[model samples]
Target: MELEQDLMVSERKKKPFRWHVLVFLAPAVIVYTMIMILPLAETLRFSFFQRDTITQAISFVGLENYIKLFFDPYWVEPFLNSLWNNCYFFLIHMLVQNPIGILIAALLSMVHLPGKKLYRIAIFMPTLLSFVVVGFVWKLMLSPLWGVSKGLMKSVGVGSWYLPFLGKEETALTTLSLISVWQFIGIPMMLIYAALLSIPDEVIEAAECDGVTGISQFFKIKLVLILPTIGIISILTFVGNFNAFDLIYTTQGPLAGPNFSTDLLGTILYRTFYGQQLQPGDPNMGAAIATVMFFIILTGVAIYLFFIQRKLTRYEM
Candidate 1:
């Protein structure tokens, strides 16, 4: 027994302490906790308290803010409208952007395609442009007077088709959504393109040997293999669209003008937090809205992880 105990102690001592791992990870861990975790916790804490409108005193109000948010028409109306717009924005991307990306990726993946590198760069270049630049450029291009869009339409012999899309409430949100799709479509295209390229040559050869070729083979094999990538892109789109603010704010201002037709949750949060012309800024309400946004993003990611991700089969190459 004594001999066995000694041997066990010797074995335990042989395992060296890995201080290097901790040293490498400490900076990132500390940074993340400070930047992300602490702020998130503070936001949640603020949501449950309220400040007196006149006295400027804060007091615990529990779920009163949430209740007011849901039941008060002043808050509820804009919140619902923004939420719906956000969903519509996400839907447009899912329907239009991703399908187009897949088609482009398919074409780009073709063997011996000419100017393939140039085409990829051209498509992706817009994504690197700042949102301020993109918004300003598009706003100018869509200007009713002396804008290239109008002139281009006339040149194409479809002069009647041109409208001030950004000026009209009905078309503003849709136009912006399409513009966003144009800028970021390259992301999905590149991701899907890489997934396609990663498929082993042996698999292609085997498929050809078995008489599987062309469009039919892509639908059956390549598409199936990249389902996991598609799922990831969908989740990314959800998170990004839900958090979208910059372009809308730049183009339409904090009012999200034309009767708030282009308002989104991010805009709502901004307006509520910062106050507008007549409205006083409500930090507690702003924090509540932010907390709700966090939960919404969390719920979406959780659904993807617990439900969607599990079902996607990542076939080994």
Candidate 2:
């Protein structure tokens, strides 16, 4: 009976001290729930209701807002255009940014690179600046009046190629996407670099012993180990790109000017929620757009988690 009592006491003593964990986590949880989740849920709820113009009375609209958004030609065209443009923007980042980031990170990881710290700092410096700052700076640099890009192109004997990229409908979206990539490339580089650093030196040395050196070593060893990190970076990129707003807003203005050439989902949401010069504000429609965006982002994340991530094996090394 004494042994049993002692064992019970020991088990009680061994129980985790959850109070400290709760104390540490409570503030962040409360803040996140209040600020993000609650507001998001409220927005979703608001999408199903309509407000009266005269009495400002609200009434349940079922899927009326969604139906109008899809079936109505006026709203449907711009919404689809913005959706497609957003997808293109995301595709550009995935193709250009990730590869460039990986290359930069791989170069930085080289043991004997001269002034490596300086290079890293210089590369990462752009990412620290606000989206507004990046957008304005790039806008000025690309401005035909400023002639900075033209001068550089002239120096490279490609002066004829210099054009008002931002003003042209043909090139505006791609230009904006590339500008975004330039500013944010540091993120993936830092992530991949950290993943590379986490790798055991002994494992790399063993690969070297087995005649795996240079690019061969990176592909066969480092690449395999960093697959999990790459997967994480990809998902994060998807979320960030889908949610992107500030840079486009600052650079192209709320109208996404030059015949709405650069209109993205973020800009579309802005125009919908807040009245533009030509278009009137529709809060219910805005909510519906927001809901659609939320679902699109959720779908992308789900695909990544279930399909892409499952195939990526994170090795113990």
Candidate 3:
């Protein structure tokens, strides 16, 4: 009874305060709230209001702008176009970029490859350059007048298929998507490569002893282990693709030209927020668009977290 009473008394004592810990977090918290949260809150506020064109008067309009965005044919048409285009862009990345990345990483992960460092560098070099550089470089090369792409096509005996890809409605979006893929393929390759490298050699040796070799070892063992990494990359790709603007803007301008065939949400937001040839800039409408985008992204993240992420098993190394 005496020993138990002593233990209870000790446990009842209050823990020491740590005020110093707050100093480390204070700077980051304040900066993030100011930079990210503040702007987001302000944008949200703007979305529920309306501003008159002539008088420049502001008034609360509730969901009017949002309704217009979705139901008003003039607005809904462009909005839907951008949304579908964005989805297609993301789907292409999921299909093309990721598979190619997996293939390259699988190859690079194997031993005894010569000049592997050089190959890695060559693959990743485009990612290091600015969107401006990559966009302009490709644009110039693909220009009909320059004839670089034409010349190469001719040499390969497929010159007849060559056209001004960037200026055509049918090819503009796909051409840009491929360009984006080429620039960013390095990221997934490196991520998947790192994940593969981190797998335990002991695990591999055990699998080998059990006669799990060649493609069987890769598919049954290596691929399964790296699934969590793939999940992270997928979510990252989703967020990045939705937020993409720099490349399109730099290459095709804010109009996302060739009849807006390549127009995405980012470009649409830009054109709306800043005023294009016909539409005057309306902060309220712009804010409404932005608010909708935030929810769309949030929904995607939620689905990924609750559904896809839970399905993947994380193995302890």
Candidate 4:
């Protein structure tokens, strides 16, 4: 009798099932499944099969396309070049943009900075512009005949240093990377600034009580606490960099310009699937490249999730 009464009491204590909650969530869940999940699944499925060009017959090719991608000279060279360029692109963001963002964020997070709001708006303004607009504007600004960059350089007595940056094979990719960095640095800065803002006032007060001040306080207290935000931004940067195409396509064209110096995996994938000029498009081969890129990005995400994210200490407020 006692056991029965206890069981009844525990059952009563449990909250009643809320079927209406599911009703509220149903639209979003259904839409996400249709929009995101279905497309990705179909893309993955397409990668495994070979498609006939004439009859439009599709057949299972197993790993034949992937094997070709690895060993074929034409595929291998361009694939490797794009891969290297992507690594360099990511490296520039990680090394140059991230540090500068942190610096700017740290400066902005100061309690009483004059025109801080205006500064933030100005810094982040580029990020709000369309990639096409930014690309075209920069292209014109950098053009020698247009003289924006050349005039600026002359003002600094370095007009002779002006070169056709986008036209040069060696400098083209680096210039694009820098342009991308300039546009996106605001993301990391804003994220880091928000992280800094979330720190408890008590923590900073305690640090000040302990004679911690200025840069030392920022380094020891604020920066340490914002590691999780930094990690999140890093992973976001990785994904954005790997999927980068719009700006490159807008600025440099599908050919990736100057003997393919700025070619990236996304641009390659685009060219492969759609064809360019005399070279015919190969959908099956393009799917293989897409599959490779998917795996590469998936691998990076897995490593970050399982390894790096695990190491980050999530502090309780």
Model 4 whole-model lDDT (C-alpha atoms): 0.91
User: Candidate 2, after superposition: displacement of residue 207 in Å?
Assistant: 2.0
Give the TM-score of each candidate.
0.95, 0.92, 0.94, 0.92
Comparing 3 with 4 on TM-score, the higher-scoring candidate is 3
TM-score of 2: 0.92
Return the candidate ranking by TM-score, descending: 1, 3, 2, 4
Where model 1 places Cα greater than 4 Å from the true spot, the runs are 1-8, 13-19
The alpha-carbon deviation from the true structure for residue 89 of candidate 1, after best TM-score superposition, in angstroms, is: 0.4
Q: Residue by residue across 210-307, what tens digits does model 4's lDDT show?
A: 99999999989898899989999989999999999998999999999989999999999999999999888888788788888989899989999999
Look at candidate 4 and tell me the lDDT of residue 207.
97
The C-alpha lDDT values of all candidates are: 0.93, 0.91, 0.92, 0.91
TM-score of 3: 0.94
Alpha carbon lDDT at 158, candidate 3: 100
The digit string of per-residue lDDT tens for model 2 on 155-192 reads 99999998899999999999999999999999999999
Model 3 spans > 4 angstroms off:
1-17
- Quick one: how many clashes does candidate 3 have? 0
Model 1, position 285, has a per-residue lDDT of 98
Clashes of each: 0, 0, 0, 0
Please give the distance, in angstroms, between residue 128's alpha carbon in candidate 3 and its true position after superposition: 1.2
Report the error of model 3 at residue 268, Å: 0.6
For candidate 3, the lDDT comes to 0.92
